[model samples]
Target: MELKGIHHVSALTANAADNYSFYTEVLGMRLVKKTVNQDDTSVYHLFYADEIGNPGTDLTFFEIPRAGTTYPGVSSISATSLRVKDDNALQYWKQRFIEYKVDHDDIITVGGRKIVSFRDPEGQRLKLVSDETNNGVKGGTPWKKGPVPVENAIIGLGPSHLTVNDPDPTIKVLTEVLSFKEIDRYPSLVQGQQDVRVFSTGEGGTGAEVHLETRPDLPRERPGRGSVHHVAFRVDNEEELQYWKERLQSARLPNSGLVERYYFKSLYFREPNGILFELATDGPGFTTDEDPEHLGESLALPPYFEQDRERIEARLKPLDI
Candidate 1:
């Protein structure tokens, strides 16, 4: 089965209120869904994305208070890369970051394209790469009314980089199992000799590309705030989702079983590098729980948690976004 692109990149956060403000207020992404994690209702599961919460636009967070910082190493999604229009768009964000004092670096070229590295308030690694070098700019519309205007708003995800000790096994799973093509290999932008391998989809866009940062010297990373919990690959619908489940299990990869995420159907598993990966469908999306016009207006809970809404609400802190 062919995969479209990335669905969403989920990470951890220590405080929901701060995570909400950083993504919504600083990053200018819309709060598409304000919900709790189904299994762990005590912690908030917040989602940020373009208006209407398109599949590729999702960048979600699980608020685990004081989750601490991560130590750089293997088996970790080191950076979640996002795309902007061009150098002009990169400059737009640079000025915004300058004005707000957001921790970031000046524009740096990567694989012949410009990218500005930045971090969220909770220390989650992120970078903004220009669309100048991709096959074509994504067609998805940005939320024009957001804090950042349509001209400067983030287009969608770019290459969510994964750092690992060995790239062979993970590359095997991606090429043979997931069917992602090894398009090109480039010099490591972040390390010497350890060249980064680029794998892209037959269909390229939001979740189109992934960069394997092969660093054998670095130790394994510990789970904590600022670290990506999982990177989801897009499936057009349930049929695609099921096909992948069988494919992964057939390859002898242990999976999380089928999980009902309310808005989407998901099957999760870890790749060779110990980085968690997910297969997520595009339908029954954010609008399933709330109207398009008023998504993320209030705290939303799954059916199982509906009975204990009051207690859950009281336990979770209100988002200041």
Candidate 2:
């Protein structure tokens, strides 16, 4: 059973309203789901994605109001990328970042693709990669109603970046256990470090690759606001998700088995270096409970939480999006 590409990447934010504004207004992504964290109902769990919140398009955030700043190092999902149409789209975004006064770097090539690296107000590391030369795992459609024009809008997720002290353990899990094939390598942006290795799954394109960097000199990351919580890969359905759970168990890896995310099923496990990875299903998506036209317009809770909606809503701080 081969897994699909990325399903979603969840990060942390101290302020849901500000996060909402930045992702929707500045990044031009649609706020597809405004919901509470299932584990803790007091805070917000916001999802931003391309039009209709398709699988592989989601970039989610968990609100941790008092979270501290992230001290970047090894064993972290150091950077998460969003895909754009082409090289021209990168130029459009570069200019737009200047217009918005957003923190960004000039367009640069990474692993044979053009990309513009940037950060959110909370210092969450992000990159916009051009899909001009991509041939595998097609990206999602942009939100037409968002601020940016369709041609220049952000599409879906690209290769996720992982930093580790030693790459062998992580590489072993990715290759032997997860079935990701090492496809390419590129010079590390950091001087004197080993070259970054590229790994791909499923269709093997921009959307399906993982960029692994080894940084033995750095310490473990202190996760807080702006740090990625976990990165999820796509599973086709519940059957496949169950298979993955069994596979994880058989491999003697500790995991959260068969998590009912309501919108989708999931199984979460951490690799050898402590980076959280989740295998998630593709169907029963954001549109499950809310109308596509009005997604994120109101607070959404799973069926189990419906009875407690009043109390849940009372505990949540109103997001002024």
Candidate 3:
């Protein structure tokens, strides 16, 4: 079975409150889920997306109050992209970033599309890509009531950038194992390096691409605040997730088989370069527990964690969104 585009990219953040402010207030994405990390109940796990949290639109963060700075290097998810409606929307965002004092670079074209790179307060490497020419997997609707104008608001996630020491092994996993097709390549921003490769899966476009940057000279990344923890690709449903688990096993790729994430089922594994990858189902989404209109308004816990809600709430610092 073919995989859909990206499901979500989860990153690290030391301060949930500030992370909440930047993503919601500045980026104008909706905070679709306010919850705790299932693996670590002591910290906050926040999700930001378009109006309602659609599978491919979510950008999540796991709060680690004492997390240190990320040492950028190879074997990392170097950059995460958010899609805007068009090139004109990129212009609007450039001026908005200026007005809000958000750190950003001038708009530039890459891989035949315009993009503007930027960083959050915690130095999360991010970019806004124009979807004017996109015709594959569709983007989501922007939040109508968010701070940014609806026309120029961030819609959904685009391609994720992966930096690796040896591209061959990662490329093998992406192509032979996961069935991503190499579609294009562009000169690396770093001088004298090989051109960055672009790979895409089902319904290829901005949303379905993985840009591979080979950095043989760099060391392995030391992940902390602002570092992407993992990038997940979307599967159609639980049955498809099971098929993927079997496929990973058949390929002798070690994985976390069929994890019940509550909102979605998942299977986690690392490509040969040690970059974490997850295959996640698209259904039983964020609306499973929270009402659509009032999502992210209160602390939400899965059924299993409901019993410990009081203890979990006691440990988390109040986040004002």
Tell me the TM-score of model 2.
Answer: 0.99
lDDT of 1 by residue, 1-321 (tens): 688888899999988887787788888888889999887888889988888888788889998897988876888899998777777899999999998889999898877789999987777889998887667326345777788988878877778898889999999999999998887777986546577888887476435888898888888998798889999988888887888999998999999877888899999999987989998998889888788888898888878778999999898877754
**Which residue segments of model 1 deviate by more than 4 Å?**
136-139
Model 3, 158-216: lDDT tens digits are 99999999999999999988999999999998899999999999998989999999988
Candidate 2 colliding pairs, count: 0
- Where model 3 places Cα greater than 4 Å from the true spot, the runs are none
Ranking by lDDT: 3, 2, 1
- Model 2 ranges off by over 4 Å: none
Kindly indicate the candidate among 1 and 2 with the higher TM-score: 2
- Residue 214 of model 1: what lDDT? 86
Residue-wise lDDT of candidate 2 within 1-321, one digit each (tens)?
Answer: 688999999999999989999999999999999999999999999999999999999999999999998999999999999999999999889888999999999899888999999999999999999999999999988888999999999889999999999999999989888989999999999999999999999998988889999999999999999999999999999998998888888888899999999999999999999999999999899999999888899999999999999999988888876
For model 3, name the residue pairs that clash: none
> Which residue window of length 10 is worst by lDDT in model 3?
238-247
TM-score of every candidate: 0.96, 0.99, 0.99
